[model samples]
Target chain A: MSTPIETDVVIIGAGPVGLFAVFELGLYDLKCHLIDILDRPGGQCAELYPEKPIYDIPAWPEISGQALVDRLMEQIAPFSPEFHFNRMVAGFRKLDNGRFEVETDEGELFHAHAVVIAAGGGSFQPKRPPVPGIDAYEGTSVFYSVRRVEEFRDRDLLIVGGGDSALDWTLNLQPVAKSVTLVHRRPEFRAAPDSVNKMFAMRDEGKVRFEVGQVTGLKGENGQLSAAMVKGPDGEIDIACDRMLPFFGLTMKLGPIADWGLNLHENLVSVDTEKFETSIPGVFAIGDINWYPGKLKLILSGFHEAALMTQAVKRIAHPDQKLVFQYTTSSTSLQKKLGVK
Target chain B: MTKISIVAFDSTRFDVDAENGSTVMENAIRNSVPGIEAECGGACACATCHVYVDDAWSEKVGSPEPMEEDMLDFAFDVRPTSRLSCQIKVRDELDGLVVHVPERQA
Candidate 1:
């Protein structure tokens, strides 16, 4: 029953498209508040391929993923759009007053005249390792991420994966946990060389056990893990542990957006090419999440959708204001919003 | 065009004529081969397009680069011959290559 934050528009994502929407909406004096599942503004650009170069972005022949997101943030700075990081929009419903109410999994609520779903490929969730029957022990005996270090104090911990998340936690929790076993598919690690060397140093002192293998099976009762069956280079061996943490990286899931009762075409929100508005009025979908006849999931396409969506949003937010479109290059009013006039 | 075959987990074979410079992952998607998600669209980012090289074609297909190897850590049930299909280009040497899709993608 908390008070909802009121705004002109509530953007469901903070990626490149969502960031650009702020610029388009800001030109017409529409305020925006964006919510993202990731801790930062950029979605896939920041998470999946930060350093990976993207060749198709207009004007710039070559730009890295993180660099594109950074530029988008800079472009949208004039809008002063509020960002809610590490939050997922769980509940979405139309209010009786014609405004839309967006709720997060964390219970924060927002009321806006319009909603922009710029969610690209949905939210990035931690990938669950393909070990059989791992779901039963998820909350109790298994954890994909560490929220508190003290939770593993004096417990037998089995850490799996060759990535930095696995190595860093193995080193960090070794002293805190009663016993630590680091298991991987290979001896070669994707983690930093310095951490690998320190891990080897720790293994030499008999403080931690590093095994080259994968957890094939789990033995536990009622979500209480007893031991894990490791298929290693030698053979199937049991590693006794009460807790297990497997870091397999992340995957994109459509998440709660599917439950909003919007017209969907193969898991993507069905929208018109005009304003990119969904079946529900005032609720617009753009970027990769939206589906049209000839829609491309490129950043440029999303940018175009944002510009059109903002014009429609402005009419809804300010019903009495006169509608007049002007270019940022020629219009003093638009330039004033950009703070260049 | 180079010939390549993608064997699904159910053993369904999809033989395709792939263009040179295109990736094995693209050919799988173009032919609608099941079990090859290629979620990242051949960026060598996501490991959903993972495939195991047929024993005979393993040596000719070659091993994954360091970047592709790092991405393979995100894949499920990664075997010794496991490779992200996007990393495998359709070169003439790889003609008549065969790769088996795994049970599930990450």
Candidate 2:
């Protein structure tokens, strides 16, 4: 019901590819707004392996994932692209006038002349533990992330995982929950030592219980959980709890994009290499989320796709404008657009 | 070449002649061994390439390094001998290495 923010292009993912698209699109004076599921821009480069070195990026001998993302951010700064973080594009439809409308999960709408989907792999979603039948309790007695701390008040909570999410939530929710039990596969924790120590201190005081194990089963009725069966070192044991929070980590899923009626090859959107445009007019797919014959899922390939896609996007956004190819090294106009003139 | 055997959850066996310096995960993927997702492509980031080292070879394969150990925390049903196959490089000492793929990856 709210007014949609209008833009020349709405990029679906704020990964390196998407960030580079802003630079390409900006060269032609096209405004852009990027929406990403992550809190920051880097996508997998930030989430999965920020410190890991990436060797394939062109010209750079070696750069860490986070470093590459940082450099891209700097490269796109002149464009002043608007970023919508911690949001997912839930709805997408083409209007009769030939423009596109995208709605986020938070209900914000964006109207754009062209849409670029540079979602690498897909949207990063919280990984669900491999416990059998756990899906039945999702959104009710089981939750992967804590949106509000008040929800667990006076409820028995079982927190699973050895990472920061599990330990942080354990320490934060222990006060509100009637009881809190921290479970992991090993005694060693991957969380910060400070949080792990605080959790252990709480355990020593009998405020919480720390068990080394994995949750193998869940007992509940009609989406309400009562107990969790854990296989610990000693043996199998049942931990009684009404709520469970498992922080396994995150995995990429081809979520709402699959339902947008676009042509899909396997889980990837089919795009033409000429313009990187999908089957849908004025909509494009690039990076790992796109598929073509001999398409390689590399950052450099995505950058090339972005440059090519921008040409087509400019045509859709400004049908009357004459297209001119200019290199940043030679053109004063391009340098001015990049703010280097 | 080191001969490595990767056993899938359903008991499917793939024996690959893994070249030295190549990872066990690479060989499994080359042979199309099912269940070795290796989602992060041997970055030691995602733990989808989880496999249980055959008991006899556990000593020879050695324990996971600290980074791999941290990544294993994301794997499913991790056991004492659980290792990310991507971190296990093929070498002369690891000849005839046998690892069982887990029921599911993280």
Candidate 3:
């Protein structure tokens, strides 16, 4: 294992709020190292609704979730916050000197004076389907997410589930795959009306096949699928397919955060509104992962909390440095620090 | 360039040249105007950039899209003239536009 990453702060979650925390903490001259379970930043925004338009942001009337994340990435560019992606924080403990040490599931360790829990709704993991032997085909013929569209090219793809992901992949993979079959236990879909309608249209046009059933069995050897046993209303039917896409949605768990010895209410970390610090000093919580009176679980609300949290974080990180309230607009020192000159 | 006036909750007003293709949020951040957090960097994902369009310019600023309307529901105080600054684009026709930033965003 590599040496533990030493920094002033270790911010868990690279969502909008966590990314903003980097800017706030950086303003106080604190270096930050961020870790997220997702392979990329933006959390739910990039993972769930990258293209969905949002209208409530204070300045812009409307912006896509992905664009918001991109701009934030740019805004925080000057901070150079380090990110450890595709890793889950597995261990957290207070060091003897009052600093904190955090370890990831990947065995990477991080040491910091302050720890900020910006994880929004915890980590998102795909709900595994109930089909036995499905795990045997995972990473080869069974996938929860379509990382690359070309991977399904020329293959027989059978997509399961009634949500957006199933319908979306059915529609997207229809043209590329040699054959596309969509299977859902219910006729009613929870997907967007537009996408559901388009999927039906494609099915009616013979571009895709629709089956009402649940994948009950997987037929494959060494992770290569040859067929799937589907349980329809009539009976079990076998569908020839090389790939199975199941979109059973995601489950969010507090995970190791709950075991860190912090006070928790309703599976959320409780913190004070002033410093947003949890029961443990040197450890703070913000964003949806934190709960406080009158707390609105909004991205900007987390941003404001991050701003206030950093003041306390600065005191912890560098007790010798005097804290000052300065605006990025007119503070020449801040401007110089940000390399704005 | 067009000129836009952004008034903060304290009634502190800032008049800056608005870039033709930039959104009002961009102009506020560029001028370092307070009260407009633009936390998501103008992404409509958060309500930090909430602003009240001057009554006279409400029609000129136009109405919020359905998606924007859904988001405005989360703003601290929603008003007929409350608009997300990020959604309003700057153009020659929007010159002299004035908006008031809320004391605190949602």
Candidate 4:
């Protein structure tokens, strides 16, 4: 409903490739605004393996995934690309003027001359716990992720699952909650060794309760949870709690990107090797989401594709201008734009 | 340089020379070999670069590592000869490496 944020390009997904695209587009004097489902950028690099060492990056022989992302962020700082985080782009339409308008699930809208999809493996959505009727408590008593930690303060919390998220939050919320109880299908955990050990230490110290069971049912009224039925090895038991946090891990789905009408080859956006442009003329696909002959889903490959796509984007965005390729190493205009002088 | 032959599902043959220490997936991308989509680069993350090693080169190509085998689970078709091209590092012994790429990667 509000006036769409106007920009030269709307880049979906703030992953490493999307971040790099900003720099490439900025070199051509095109402004970019990025949208990501996560609260921060770096997609799989940050989410899955932030501390994992990457060996194949061109210049950097060894850099952690998160460190590489941080460097990219610093590199694009001069561009000042606008970032719209914690929002899922749900709607897209091409305007009569050849511009594209995209609306996020949060109701924010963006109008841009070109759209670049750098969404790595699509959108990551939390896998809901298999408990029946858990939907009623999703936004209220039950939560998949701890957005604001303070919201659990002084409340009776029942955290479930056996992953890093569950153990991490159990340790964090124990000191503040009225009582913190962790429920799992088994005593074992797939979380990090240290966190798992700390959780057991807390349980031994009587600071928290560890119940080996599965959450079978919920007892609440009008979206407020009062208790949860746990199916233990012996029998069912009800644990009183005001809040339940279940860390069931996350699954990546193509989400709204699948509905954008682009040709998809096995859930990946199919694009040409030359321009990285999708079936749609003004739309482009890069990074892990693109499919082409001999397409290597490497960050370096995406970087190469981003460079070529930017050339195409510049032509489409500035049709009247004679596009000249300029090397950043020697181009005074580029150095000035990058503020490297 | 090691000569590598990659055959697509349509039986299109691409013969290229790759430097030692490089990967089959890298050489395929460099030579624009069809049906080789190494989407994760060479990270062994995505199994897009799945290939079936030729019977003669099967033992020479070796078996996919545990990590590569795990990733192979996501590939289109699983066979004893299936290997992730990114994990197949080129070496002097692999001078005449031959592999067949699947129709598509899952």
Q: Which stretches of candidate 3 lie over 4 Å from their true place?
A: A1-6, A37-71, A85-88, A104-109, A121-123, A292-304, A318-330, B1-106
In CAPRI terms, where does candidate 2 land?
acceptable
Tens digit of lDDT per residue, candidate 4, span A29-85?
Answer: 999999998889898788655656688899899997789999999999999999999
True contacts kept of 4: 0.00
lDDT tens string, model 3, A1-341? 77988899999999999999999998888999999999999998887667666777889799978899999999898989999999999999888988899999999999999999999888966767657788899999998777667889999999987777788778878989999999887576767899999999998999999997767788988899999998887888999999988876554478899889999876679999999999999899999989888878888899999999999999998889888999999999889878996
Fnat per predicted structure, each in turn = 0.54, 0.62, 0.00, 0.00
Better of 1 and 3 by DockQ: 1
Error of 4 at A310 (Å): 3.1
Candidate 2 vs candidate 4: the TM-score winner is: 2
Q: TM-scores of all models?
A: 0.64, 0.64, 0.65, 0.56
Write the residue-wise lDDT of candidate 2 on A139-187 in tens digits: 9999977766788999999999999778888998999999999999889
- Two-chain DockQ for each candidate model: 0.27, 0.29, 0.01, 0.02
Residue-level lDDT of model 4, residues B60-101, one tens digit each, is 889987677656545543567999998999999999889998
Candidate 1 pairs with clashing backbones: none
After superposing the true interface residues, what Cα RMSD does each candidate give? Answer: 3.9, 4.0, 16.3, 10.7
**Which residue pairs show collisions in model 4?**
A296-B38, A297-B38, A297-B39, A297-B40, A297-B41, A298-B41
Q: Which 10-residue window of candidate 4 chain B scores lowest in summed lDDT?
A: B69-78
- For candidate 3, the docking band is incorrect
User: Which ranges in model 2 have alpha carbons more than 4 Å from their true place?
Assistant: A1-6, A13-122, A253-341
- What TM-score should be assigned to candidate 1? 0.64
Candidate of highest TM-score: 3
